[model samples]
Target: MPQDDPWDAEASQHVARNPGRPKAGFYGAVPEDDEDGRHPSSDEDEEEEFEEIEVVPVRPKLSVAIGGFAALLAVAVALGAQTTGPDARLSYAIVLFGVQLLGLLAWTMALHPPAAGATAAIVALTALAADYLAVTGEPARFLPLIWVALGGFVAAMIGQFIRAEDRQRARDSWRSTLLIVLGAVAYAILLVLVRQPLGAQTILVCCTGAGLALLVARLTDAVFPKPRIAAQVPRGATGVVLGAMLGTLACAMLGSYLVLPFTPAKGAVLGLVAAVAANLIDLAVNFGEAGRRLAGEAPTFWLARHMQGPLGGLALTAAAAYALTHLYLS
Candidate 1:
């Protein structure tokens, strides 16, 4: 059989065939030749489309290492506070301020800065509170706890404000500031209520509960992705609040059983009530902070990180100190 003539087939096809057109091949269509027989326009278009992406700078490894070392040194100083004798107040002040500084440093250096700093501060304060409680072997008081919380709030705010970027400072809006103030007042009221009934023990129970809640919330986040919520609401706020409430209740029950020697059933009831009160305060403050941060108007304050965590720890410290002082006096 004779092979079909390509020229005859091309003549039969009505599609106008240009001699200059590139031939179709098994691979695919080929680029059309320009007047110059080169795809110069394509090359130029490609050049025009090229873009440079901006790379964000991260903190240097050396700087992060130095920050970690400094935090460790601050912890050592805080540990020395336990042996300060009559100068216990001064020592306590040192520990409190040192912890705040360490927190800030951790925030700047750690991969998950906020979590790193918050965890470090919580662990340090909790350990200190436990040691003091163990040494005193007595119930804690209220006034000292209140004072410490106030002092820590003031100190942390000042330190953070000083270090905050000028842009952050300028972005503070009146609405956010008002929210922060209201949150603080609400927290203060809650503290007074809990103190009236539970005394300084409220500090220990609340701090431990909040810490455990944070840990649980972290685990939950790892397991389940967070849902998108309104801008006013922070991600994971609901879960964290719920976790905090349950943790607070459990901690309170355990603490009461061990310290107050209450029956397990009675302790559980008290714990439940106390946890409700604590959760109310925590929920309000967290909601306020979340709104402020989302608005880009968060105050450069320690409480801005999480109102309950550091404040709770400081209150516990005050309670521990009061217990130790009373033990020494009696």
Candidate 2:
């Protein structure tokens, strides 16, 4: 019976002890199992999961706060340092720019709505104040009133965009981008048509139209959407379209600047170029952030879901475009 033992007793014991364990096959060391040998989750899976998480870096919050406070302090110091009364007031403008600029950069990177809106408001107010101071007499004194109204309008529009409670997608983004371009073109055309409408009246009409348009756009989106269109345009395509548009606009502006020296245009081509160039530069930088958003990366935690805020690239682009168009005309 002992002579007839057909199996190795040690091997049989090992097999019994480690059931289903990979074995040193007959050929070499343990033959790798036929299981999918990936590192558990795929890269796409990780990104999708990451996209779900809001990424608000702590450093930005602290840095922005410190910078904002320091800017205020600097403004106070500048005021104290000034010898003349007008200069002291002028220091306020400088302070305002410093604070708002720092805040704007932070809000843009952090993608926060309230913070960004506040920053923009500060900038507009400063500009208005500076304009008022630079002007002469009663009109200048009343200028702040006009600014107050304009500031409110700007604030409201930016707030509406920021607070819009809707999930973002490619088609919606593109549509918004188109509408913005159209709006800017319309405003530029309107300025020409209005000829010499009082500034106050012009501002009022523009604000009213903008408010109505925003309402209609929101309502239309809520009510309509076919299955086919949804399938065709995935979410976030708007960002890409906007990026391309900005880049193209920038290129065109540069081209015009290059050509300006050679030919004399009826209008101030150089001024147009300068205005567009300034706006395009800002847009170019912002589009980089928007590009990440479109790619489904969670770039900011503040306006994590909504990107219609002042700091939002799309909103900024529209603003910049309008400013560029108006720079020479105004």
Candidate 3:
């Protein structure tokens, strides 16, 4: 057949008239396997491999350690309060120190960061110092279980104090304070209804006094929170050494309960003096440290450090007072 005129042919004319489309691959079309083999799917495998993560519960060892420590602390305080004979007192103090160290160690391991961990270390050291000093006094056989219970009570009170202060929660409020006082008084009256121990009256008085003091202190803080001082005692070298020496002297004066023949009044005065001296010494260490310009790890510190000398002194004084009262009056 005669070829149509090239430009006049119908299909040729249509192609010339229409605009041309770009090639598929030129427009970013995904290229298929030219060889006809299927590619392996990395995405499919990834989807299949994905999982929902599950979390395992971690039991809190900190709480347990804290509880145990608190039990030991309360026991120590109560035992310290109850025991007086040189031998009995010394033995209890030793045990109290040991338990306190254990508690401090447990707390260090359980909750506090390394920086603050030194608090526990200081407490442990103080306990050791107390124990060492306690050795100068005679040893007696007393109830271990009592000491343990008292220690636990003291620990609980201390822990409670710490918690309350940290959260600024009041363990005792105006209402609670009133309640505690009234409850104590009520309990004292109840003591009459149900005959109790020989010295229940005095015991009641001390318990009530302690409770009231604690409540008052806490409530006062809650009402007017004051800035806290450095945990460690501040002092100059001379001051700290002086304080430590005073601490030592207080220990010796307290140890005198074993040797001294005096009234509780005399012991009380001596104990009071020892306590004051020891506290002055302890405070001086902190004051002295503050005066210096050096910086490093916080000195091992505890409230007990401030307290021990005074406590020991007071105990000795009380013993003396009791002895004198009994001897002269009897």
Candidate 4:
């Protein structure tokens, strides 16, 4: 039988290199990380590997559990709100404060910005002050949370001057501070909401929507975190939109039974605001983490990183709840 193709050329192509002394390193070569012994691949194998590997999204069990926890907090918020008769805001305050501390921890750890300790301290103190103002001040005073946030901003700036040595850190510290401090103080809005005539009911309705939105989004992401918002951020657009719709539906149902100002239509509008705010903020945290990771920063603890997303979302929802309730009721 005749050979299909000649092997001589292929065999010739496999010829060994001529024996020679190895070339010396260039004088212009960079010295940084030289001792690490890893050389840049000309073939770009890592990028190919990244493209080939599938993203492992959040586990269904974990998503369900996290969502369940958010729902549980919703229950707690309702219970605390109802318990707000004489001298009982303390119970709700306790609950809100505990959550604020948790958010503080998660934000501080995930951000790891300069003057982190100072940022945490300022946020904690401001949260305490804001809660006190909300609890003791005249009913429907929206000024307290604002004032506390302003103070936090000032303190955060001072902290930057004192502790931010890196120019990059000086730029980033402000963002970290605002996220942590503002998030902590916004919880006071609920206290203000509780002071209204139908405030507790409002709390119930709003939290139901907000919590359900987060819950649904999480569970949805676990099952179908596809059409992902971004490759690095493992959340799906499907989950976010579906979560918002369902959350609005839940609030509308609650509002139908509750009262006049909180009619189903009104409640649905509020739910839309809260739900969108909640999901977006949660998604924002993931985007931030992705940014840091891609920039070669140290990875945050897995749990803390995940925990911050929900906590930030809920925190922002407080302001949304206050603004919307006041718009409809007042």
Candidate 5:
């Protein structure tokens, strides 16, 4: 074995003796950011690190419960269309109007826009007016829905300035108001659909498909969120594809109970179209949530936040139902 270098020991002793001296690499000594290894919130130090995570993490129990709620909502609308006999349109309008109110409430809370109270009131009253006009006036005329939407939009924008917190924010409220107004108007489309021949059956099948799709998608997300659609969004690609297929199958099964001009094949078609439309709208909600999160805004309560997607989906599906009935049955 070789003997130790006495010069190395002497050098070490010299370095230890002159602790104030800087090392070869720099002009002065460098101190660690955190001697205890704590990291800053920004993770800027060598000792700190953080990876991007989902803005909205998935919760299994919550997802399942939301799924069930979406299904019940669909079922309620279905019953309104099917059970009222000669007054089916009126019944459907009433039921759907209630659903629209719920949606507006949730949406207003989620956005919390300037003049939010007045915005909600304007949208709700617009919905009421549209519903009354649809049910009382000419059943075949569709003009009332348009006029109500336009008038409601103008009122919503003007109402923004009534008690403005900030002029810019008040201006921003207009877009949100437009969404609620359009959604309420969309519900009135159902009244027209119900008044059409065989329209009740169309609502049953399409609503079944939409509701079941949302339910199945939510439950599936609870169980398996693998192949995640986006890192920021907690939805699963598996759930979306499987939900749509199951919704189609369910609609097909429902076709047998339908009267003339509908078959299993036609029901499947309606389910496909309606389910796609509903799921797309639902997915858009998640995307909006992602955007808001990225903008550093905190979300509202989980239950209230999650529900508007499904309700919005069902609201728009009414339009799809009308179109499909005309295509397949007319």
Candidate 6:
């Protein structure tokens, strides 16, 4: 004997009553309405369901705890660097990198997930150990690492303010791009200017080079927009790198001709490193964003977003600047 279809009875009943409507089961069927012309369940049910969902509040206490730990670590590194002799340039570089890393971590944790704050703290300590193993020297000779540390915190706060304003204003794409470029230029200038007692000529050369690089990058972005086929690569990455290379080369040649203390070869080297670092930073940011969006609320997601993206970029840029000032200067 063959089994009967279970939907047959209901289908026949509805089909006979509503001849114009299609048969109902899974698809192409409208819900049956009563004499009042309303479904059995109304929108009120959905509203109540939505109302029951709870919103999690952000906990500032966690951010504060993590930031405090980072501050202590930074103080320890700074004190260690100060106690070291003047010849330990490598030690100074490591300390500078640590301070920069801590400052960036603090900023990211304060803004992003509170739990990821611990991850940022751990990374800072790990970096310190890695740097110690990688390079050994007496201490920084030219620039003060302490200023770079302080500058990190200041930059973070300023960045947070700008970011909030941008979101509130709903800035368009072009305006957003312009703001980011300008911010980068401002940061570069700040880094250079923070080195007190710098000669007028030194300041002029450094600022000009940094500013020109940024301008060239911005112009290049306008002229040669990323191609559709280049979707695999982050937008503006190629243009920014190319512009930084060209601008840095131009500045290096000019600096050499102007009889700047650093050799032309050193200038070219610094420009090349800066270009590479900029590209890497862009890639890291793109990758981090994509990872976060795909992974949702996972701890790994927050870790990548907070630690690997912005903080990584800032560290590379700081390292490049330190090398340029300390290694090249007479």
TM-score of each: 0.36, 0.26, 0.24, 0.80, 0.80, 0.37
Clashing pairs in 1: none
Over 4 Å off, model 2: 1-107, 110-197, 226-290, 294-296, 302-330
- Displacement of residue 236 (Cα, Å) in model 5 is 0.6
lDDT of 3 by residue, 1-330 (tens): 787556667877788888565444577654343344533454566767884433222123422332233233333443444553434545555554554444344333322222233334434444444344334423311122224333433433344355434324334422322221121112112112112222222222222222222222223333332333342321123322333344334334433443334334443343334334333432443344443323443533453332322232222222233332344323
Give the lDDT of residue 87 in candidate 1.
31
Between prediction 1 and prediction 5, the one with superior lDDT is: 5
Q: For candidate 1, what is the TM-score?
A: 0.36
Ranking by TM-score: 5, 4, 6, 1, 2, 3
lDDT of each: 0.40, 0.35, 0.34, 0.80, 0.82, 0.43
- Predicted candidate 5 versus true structure: per-residue lDDT over 131-184, tens digit per residue: 888777775546778899999988887888776464578765667778878887
Top candidate by lDDT:
5
Q: Which is superior by lDDT, 1 or 3? A: 1
For 213-318, candidate 1 gives per-residue lDDT tens digits of: 5444434434442452333443344445555556656765665555543444443444344334433443454455555555667354452344233333333333
Error (Å) of candidate 3 at residue 138 is 9.3
How far is 22's C-alpha from truth in model 6 (Å)? 44
Q: Would you list the clashing residue pairs of candidate 2?
A: 169-236, 170-235, 170-236, 170-237
User: Superposing all C-alpha atoms, what RMSD in Å does each candidate have to the true structure?
Assistant: 15.5, 17.9, 23.6, 10.6, 8.0, 16.1
Clashing pairs in 5: none
**For model 1, what is the alpha-carbon lDDT of residue 191?**
25
Q: Could you give candidate 2's per-residue lDDT for residues 1-330 as a string of tens digits? A: 577676689879987987874455555545444457643346567888767633322233432332233233323322322321423434433443443344334443443333344434544454444333433233223334334445544543454455445223322443333222222222122122222222222222222222222222222233332221122122123322332334344333433433222222312232233223323333343454556666887766443222222112222232333343355335
Model 6 misplacement above 4 A: 1-215, 227-238, 257-260, 297-315
Model 5 off-target regions past 4 Å?
Answer: 1-51, 54-56, 88-91, 163-166
TM-score, prediction 4: 0.80
Total colliding residue pairs, candidate 2: 4
Query: Per-residue lDDT tens digits of candidate 6, residues 1-330?
Result: 666866688888987888775435659787677689886577777777776522222233432332233234323432443344435545554555644554444334422522233334433443443344334323313233333334433333333345554434332332322222222222232223232233223433443343344444434444554541133322354456665677468557756864556567756665566545644554555454545444573333344243333333434444455556655664
